[model samples]
Target: MTLLRGLVLLSLCLASGQSAGDQPAPAGSQNAPCPLLSVNDPVQRDRLLYHTCYLSQPTDLGDWRQITPAQLPAQLKWQASNGEQLAFPRSQLEYWIRLNLKNDGPTPGFWYLALDYAPVDYVSFTLHRANGSSVIETGDQRPFDARGIDYRYYLVPISLNAGEAATLYLRLSSQGALNLPLSLLTPDELVAQSNTLTLTHGLFYGALIIFALFNLLLFISSGTRYYFFNAFYMASLGLFLFAMGGFAYQHLWPGSPWLANTAVPLSMALCALAINLFGRSFLQVRRQSPLTSRLMTAQTGIACGLLVLALALPYNHAIAIITVAALALICSLFFIGVIRWRQGHSHAKWYVLSWSLMVLGTLTYALAAFGYIPDFLQQEMIMQSAIGGQVLLLNYAIVQRWRDMQKRLWLAENRAKMRLEREVAERTTQLQDAMRDLEAANQRLEALSTRDSLTGLHNRRYLDGRLTELIREAHRHLRPLALVVLDADHFKRINDHYGHAVGDLCLRHIADELKHAVHRPQDVVARFGGEEFALLLPDTDLAGAQRVTNQFLQRLASCPAGQREGLHIPLTLSAGVALLQADETQAQLFERADSALYRAKAGGRNQLVVAGNTPAPVGTATNRNRE
Candidate 1:
């Protein structure tokens, strides 16, 4: 089925090309780019002919699982490949490498296949024998311990029988740069190259560690957020390099195949986030350039979002996001440097120099990743050098910033000394003015604290304190005091219908009604909460409070909805009246009144219920007209 699908796909590609009238291969296509690499004839101890194999990649992102060896012949005729490390434009395509190898040597031994572009996520190599059979497997995708040899990339052994002529088919897929720099090496040669690569990696890792530690200590000593961000950025960069260069797979996380797969994009995403923060803080982007500052903030958010996507999405999707974000971040940094440079930031010159190198190396590496160029340019090395320069330049920038701050502080001190006498006289006047203002503000605050701003009635705090004093006087004199608790019925309807402005006006209208209903100067009215109001009538009996409540309700009904736009929308409220009992505490009296209030609401609104009393006469309590 796989072979059949491959054949169908190949046929479809050719038919579409013809249908579109795509130009055909130029006249008598020249000889194959390079003869199939002969394994039997060793080219040199460490050097050999770089065979340019035939190549084909899926045109779509759909499954290429149907590709099989039976379709190998179809791809063999497609085209010849050229270059030590071929690059392709950014694509989510799967590629096939076709080559022929003859063991022209005397004996057969193990041959190691290596891929220099270590970040390529998955690779497959199949050795076809004279029989219809073949040996097929994959690289990089497999666990490090599972590889034929314990090396990064695809280190598989190809056991070619003496005098055997075998065809090799390799499949490559990745979310990162798509570079295919294939090398067939004897065991000794492979080890030698791996060791040389390891040494170079050690130097890079060592420098990263030093930078991270130095910045961390600098942050600790100076208490600056900038150094911490710088340290984190360097650490993330180290991890990214390790993941990309395959060192993380070999050493740090060999057991975590998931981490090995996700580490590059994750670390790079984090590195972008940290580096952006470091740049913002180092240059004071917010204070220096407000518009650019917002752009920087947005890019940082994007990098952070990509970090999550990297861990969750497939490598192909994650890589595409990381690549775009990476490009945007680099551009954003370059823009910041340019803005600061225009503003005459002294350290911005070195900052620009640093970012220029970094940008060049990043673009070159990214271009190769997308298959726009060959991989021989040592992009990884160039990026490493550029980043190192940036760290140094940023350190210098930090020092310069410190110096500038110190100079400003010194100038401020000198100005202070020159203004000492005048400042002392001014300070005396300010102190006298401050004392007068403080006294006036205290008086205003006292009024504000005691009164409700909305209704000009007593607030809850003032109500509680004043109620305590009134209760003490009532108990001491052996006199009666009545508590009237009024709750607006269906007040939410009023607010919902008329809006809160009129709702508040209606409340103030009720407050004024309570004040006008009072016959004695000692009657205190206060807004309880929301649309509820409370009244304390000292030296009053239940009958006297009952009469006052009737008067208050009548006044309330007369001014409905506070005459909004000259229209009176009426609202009703229920009330409970409780006359203080002998030795009753303030809380006990409040509870009795509250219970009566609920009973009034339960019976019907616009009515008053008296604790220890049946109710006001039916017509008197329940006869208020509803709006």
Candidate 2:
């Protein structure tokens, strides 16, 4: 590198007609004939002009000297060549590039010199005329308004009459590669080129703004975190590009030299932060792979550390750190995306593609800054183009992921609805089965409450309730109703001679006989009390009730109670009948029937008696029906 730099300086000296070991040339040497960089080509007005100029730098720290207006006229020494380009390694020493220009022509009107490279930190351009010298100084290290020309790049207005001559000198020093490309432009060329550059940068920044707004809309509409991170990354990249290109120094932070100096490195650090955040979220690293996710997190932490260092370190040091962090971010994101793609992440393809473009662009930008790449419009616009492509690819990935998520959500909702329907159907079936069991159990309970346990006849409570309902119904329908109270004759004797079981058997037999005799579906036979049973006959009369009693007696005599061992358990019964009267209360009717029962028992057993009539046969019982 040292040899190459020596050779470059040697060529610069040879082109300037000065020997390497010669004494320093005096600056005020109008008598000496030096080459004049004349802008005679109207078509190539934007081209570099051959001129008399000198380039110098301080030998060491002890040789420090202020590059002011007083010292500049005498300080300029070696002249420049028209065909030679000034290219040098990065250095801290201030370089003074002096130009002795004379427009000794017939076609010139207004001429200007423009410095192409935008990254020079401190630059001062001076136009030395015969009257006196006037200086205009501007760079990233000074206020943007301090420039002789109000433009983005370094521009100095040179007024030279058609046959007049003037000396122009420029001082430059930076922590950047010293690649000076000058254009001696006429009025037309200056206006046209300046407008072109402005329009290009305007459109570039416009596209970047559009991308940011698009991502913002996406984030708002879909509520996805990745879109937000991607938007932030685009914004940071835009700022970094703007600052690095010196537009920030000219337009954005004109009054803040410190801010202008730090903007590029700070924005670069911020870009790293955006990339890490965007990569981790876009790839879903946390959910895809824990190990890779942890790695990404570490890289993200490193990027944050770079930002902190950016605040503390100088521009040159911080920019280096930020550049390395940007590289690390690219590698980490690419690796994570590849891993996720292999592990079945569908969006990883687009993520990887986007990062690849950005990586290429970043590499190109870094190389161009180090003078490794030839400076051209394409080289200057490389990062812009690549970043635009990245924005498109990343947006597509976001849309794809959103669509996939929508599909999954729709499927989940449908499945949940179907599952709910199935559960409802199952629950309904279970309820139906339970209802059937409950109905059967309720029927058994009804029987237990109203039936006689020994004979399965309606019990006393049922007899009372049913008889009342029957009486009311019969009354409403203007029909007949009757009740017969029956008792097992010689029931006590049977119990004493045989056993209580035999007496029970006798009662059951009489109950069955009475039940069978009734025949009417609406009629009911219920056990009134011990040895007594009541038969309720709905829509029946006195004659019908009597026939039922006769039939019951025959049934009892035919089928004795039951055959016990080798003997027959015989059972005989007497009954009392009561016909309902609309005017008579239940007690009056029951009392008359009970009185008739007493008369029948008093006469003889195995006979029936009609209430308020002759005592043919009767039985003792309280009429449970109380209608």
Please give the clash total of every predicted structure, in order.
Answer: 5, 9
Cα lDDT of all candidates, in order?
0.71, 0.71
- Misplaced by over 4 Å in model 2 are 1-35, 42-56, 60-89, 129-132, 220-222, 411-627
TM-score for each predicted model, relative to the true structure:
0.57, 0.59
Residue pairs with backbone atoms closer than 3 Å in model 2 (clashes): 37-50, 37-51, 53-79, 53-80, 54-78, 450-459, 607-617, 608-617, 609-617
TM-score of 2: 0.59
Candidate 1 residue pairs in backbone clash: 40-105, 87-371, 88-370, 88-371, 177-369
Q: Which regions in candidate 1 have their CA more than 4 angstroms from the true location? A: 1-34, 40-50, 57-78, 106-110, 129-136, 159-164, 175-177, 255-257, 287-289, 421-627
Q: Assess the local accuracy of residue 570 in candidate 2 as a C-alpha lDDT between 0 and 100.
A: 66
What shift in Å separates residue 261 of candidate 1 from its native position after superposition? 3.6
lDDT of 1 by residue, 1-627 (tens): 332343343234322423211221112223455456677557631233245454545455355556666654443454454433455433345666666777777787668766676766567667777875554454456677765556666665677777887777777766444666667888888889779877877787898899899989999998999889989988988888778777789888777767887887788799889889988888888876788789889988888898899889987567656766675686668777877888877777676777776666666565555444454337667777777777777677777777877887999998998799689879867865775679887566655576787888888888888889988887777676789999998989889988998888888877777777775657788887888889988777767788878877877776676565785888778999997776777898899999999999999889999987342322232233211
Kindly list the per-residue Cα lDDT of model 2 for residues 1-627, writing each as its tens digit: 332343343234323322222222223343333455565655344335345444566464343235464554554455444444554434445667666676767855577787877777878777787888887767777777877566767777777778777777777777645556677887787789878878888988998899898888888997988888988998998898888777777777789988887888889889999888988887877875788789888988888998898889976567655776677577668767777778776778788888788777777666556443446345677878888788888888777777777887999999999999999889867865776689986566655567677988889888878877876776666676777887777788999998887777777777667767766568788897999888887766777788878778777877776665455876777778888776555566567777767777777978889886433212112222322
Top candidate (TM-score): 2
TM-score of 1: 0.57
